[model samples]
Target: MASPKRPIRIAGCSGAATDRRDAMRALAANCPNDPIDVIIGDWMSEANMTSRAASKTDNVGEAYEPTFLEALEPALPHIAKHGIKIAVNAGASDTELLHSVVTKMVASKGLKLKVAWISGDEVLPAVREAQKANASTFENIRTGEVLNSWKFEPIYAQAYLGGLGIASAFLRGADIVVCGRVSDASPVIGAAYWWHNWQRSNLDELANAFVAGHLIECSNYVCGGNFTGFKALETKGWENIGYPIAEISSSGGVVITKNKNSGGEVSVQTCSSQLLYEIQGPWYFNSDVTAILDELWFEQLSTDRVALRGVKSDLPPPTTKIGITAKGGYQAEMHWFLCGLDIDAKARMMETQIRLLLRPHAHRFTKLAFTKNGSAPDDPTNQNAATVDFRVFAQAPKEEDLMPQRFLRPCIDPIMQGYPGATPHLDWRQALPKPVYEYYVTLLPQADVQHKVHLASGETFAIPPPPQTKTYPAQQPCQAVTRGPADGGKWGRTVTGPLGWIVHARSGDKGSNCNVGFWVRHREEWDWLRTLLSVEKVQELLADEYAGKKIDRFELPNLHAVHFLLHDHLDRGVSCSSTYDFLGKNVAEFLRARHVQLPVRFLDRGRL
Candidate 1:
């Protein structure tokens, strides 16, 4: 270990469900010679957990993500040799099975690696009992739908666990710590807590740890990957992107960096982009701490290093978010593209023909939707611009009702006779009906959910509950502004152009809500942005998706960004959403493509 005065260097190898990318080998190949104290891998995702739950029911032994072992296969020997500690949340639903498999792998390799796993995120039994008893605590957060009213019974429910259990495992000297359903940032927080011996009430220090965890949680996300300003950064060797490493000191200050010889570049823009990824508003809440992002600022120390400061922390909320997955019936879609002129008319004709054909069988489906994916040709530059994808989606109670080929027979068989310039872009494999998982997100009191750490010695201990009990409102939005930017700027005239001319954007999903954050580099542009892009203006920009939805807008003056969260816009979150852009990644780009009138001074700079 480095001197006590030196910061603890922790490297994050894998982001959520990135096992297929061979993240372990990257870590093994890139472990700095200076020695990394801890390594973290984020493997669990909402989809992964739901799938793991189903897998466990099929076979008791196969509960965790098997790719996790595949990821660690190449790096285990190197890690053992270096005595480097590992804390990962790769145990999606079955941490015990993960521990068993890992210990066996360690023994087979003839290495002395102690392993521990943590549990207690599973709450299916308690939730089912409460639902059967007609408890009022299981109501859906958005729709006000009670648990008993659900069409299909939930297969599994897991509450987001905190980092205390992971911290406990590390404190007890476990070489490898595996956990199930912990929050994405928990492994980082747990490792930091153990390293610094932080107390529960150390909100300021814990807040810094939380910031570091959130920054590096997605691995390469803070290292220029998926960044909106990627083109502006040094792009050599981008194919071999470097992962994030946080050097967190005892005082909670962090310097985020990656391997010097590695690919991706780390800068203030990259860090800020990741910081705004999935956050709802200025206050980012976690199970461990609630960080206020209103005053957060990032400073670039060097090319591959950045520092974050001014973020304040408060006690965590009384409850933790819980995700419940239920069978949402079978869904199928038939895709056909309309080419050349009269795209709308062709799409309308297709919808009419398909609706008339399926009208007789309408009662069999819970939902039947016709969507025109693209619009008419604007001058026709490319084949894609002149073509529009007309799709018909159907969901039914019985799988047979959505038997893909059979259900889409009417649409496909009559395509030749229906409209001119119509063709399909998919093959037989894509025409099959797929199972949908209806995701319900709500909160459960942290006190009711128990967290336990199973030690390598076969003994377990219960983790303590959060110290504070605070309640956040169901919906919180910043005050709306009714003013415009100062008109005089070098006394130049205004010009109308795409919002992307002076704005950069990043968007992501939090449950069913979609957040899009827009930023401008110049202070002059920011002044115009804050007043130009109000909640109503944003609603206008994303008019189609924002229809009949509540939108909350917040301003980040330091980053020159405006963020808006569209409530219930993603249907029922990513898994069950019928929208083509399920994860809301395109929402920001879509908004940036919208035309807007802006000051000529900013546009003249050619910084678009």
Candidate 2:
């Protein structure tokens, strides 16, 4: 009764929070011809989860992301017409609310779709009990502070669930699945598992599908979006780019492509760049399986078509990570511009002035930070080019101290008497302080948690638990390789330029830590890169914030890439950070722009 000849095709519609609603509509419209079987969307992030958890206190159904409904409203007709199954982790912290809203919408549209809600990921009660028993064991991964030892009690906690629960829902004939806090790649893994009836121990097939899942997890990212080599796709259709789709066969062979008439190109370079996002080391862990990153390889089958292979899998770790959020008080920021010459002197003077002015009320705040962003380049062409954004950020214990009158008046009043060429930016919102929710990421034993699938028919199915309990040792460096001296005889003259002239990189945040993965286009340059970009070298590239900081480096030889994780660089993650690039998304670009010496051979391989 099944079509054994055809491979299963799944489309990734949206990557993160509120990703281009029009793009989702476009993917839905084009899916009929491509015959996409399953559609998945990812809408939850660390910032979103914290916001959603806080929203539940005000209203019942307000916790779920609104964009889920907005994206599906236009696609419902096409979905129903094509018999497409939908799965998404757009539920945020509230799956029941999302399910109710989506069910009502589907019913009102007269569409006969079975919507299933997958839950059991929430572990607040267990966390509280554990906190009471021995609090120190639930140490925050970022700061190594115990949960019970925190400044404020945690209000919400959710463990990251895996694909098995989602796959079980599909096996129960559910047309739509709304989930809370599943792994980012779970939807794709779930759809493929259900399509082929994969066994839990089918590690080979599952590993192949897992690689496919990760490739398209971020949707358009694999389709030349956010690619380091954007210039390569410049002439190609890039505007209004198509989302990524995986054509996975029954045997676990994967070929990544996009919709026929859509924009974007899916080349080896684009696929490899997406692979480096947010990864720390070679051993990539998931709730379902452990993917060996170094073993994976990519092949260009055709233009806009890449086949991912060589990925090997082992049994998953015995535990899954949990994210807990607590009130972190309030924070406010004020920005001033530093123009013309003497920029460093002006910035230092501004910091001294603000600190001295707030000295009388120093006890009112927990943290105060002064940041100088951008600099006056040599021989500037315009006033904007010579201006640097100087910011003063403060985090306070109470709302009164963080108020506009208290926080802003001190900084704004001294601006006129402050350093030469200094004036506050005319942004009113900078004066007002906003509440901060601190996040704690810790691991929970998989055995202590339960996972299940809930159906519209009021039936629930349970997934089998982990087979063994094993504590994975804290991640240590293993993959970085030692390289002998580069033979200077074959190399020609050295050229000086930005490091990105010969390297491509992608960076992202993982809790308080940030990772930047750097790669070279040519294989001949790997030896030189490995020797030049050591942990010490990377720390130097990051400048003072990373000076004397713990920086770990790993190598993915298969991709000709080197990955570095900067510990505690994000300043307690996104919600409570004073940095403008809170999530560390710009870290790679910042490093790429740093000047470095490169041999002519490697430089010639790229478009220098």
The CA lDDT of each predicted structure is: 0.80, 0.82
Off by over 4 Å in 1: 1-4, 58-61, 129-136, 375-385, 404-406, 482-491
Cα lDDT for residue 580, model 1? 85
lDDT of prediction 2:
0.82
Measured by lDDT, the strongest candidate is 2
Q: Over the stretch 1-608, how does candidate 2's per-residue lDDT look in tens digits?
A: 13635778888988988688765566667765677888988998898888787776446557888888989988888888878888999998889889999999999999998899988778888887776777438877666777667877688888888888888888888999999899888898888888888777877677777778778888889998888888866677777677888988778888999877777799878888888888777777778887778767789999788999778778888888899987788888889999988988888887888777788776799998888889889999999998999888899978888786677877887877788766898885966878888889998777767788999999988876667434556765643444574675556788888998888899888888888888886677877787778877887788876746577778877787888888888988887877888888899999999988878877666553
lDDT digits (tens) for residues 289-399 of candidate 1: 888887887888987889988889888998888888877788888789888888778878888887777766777988888888878666888887788778888888778
Clashes by residue pair, model 2? none
* Model 2 CA deviation exceeding 4 Å by range: 1-5, 57-61, 468-470, 479-485
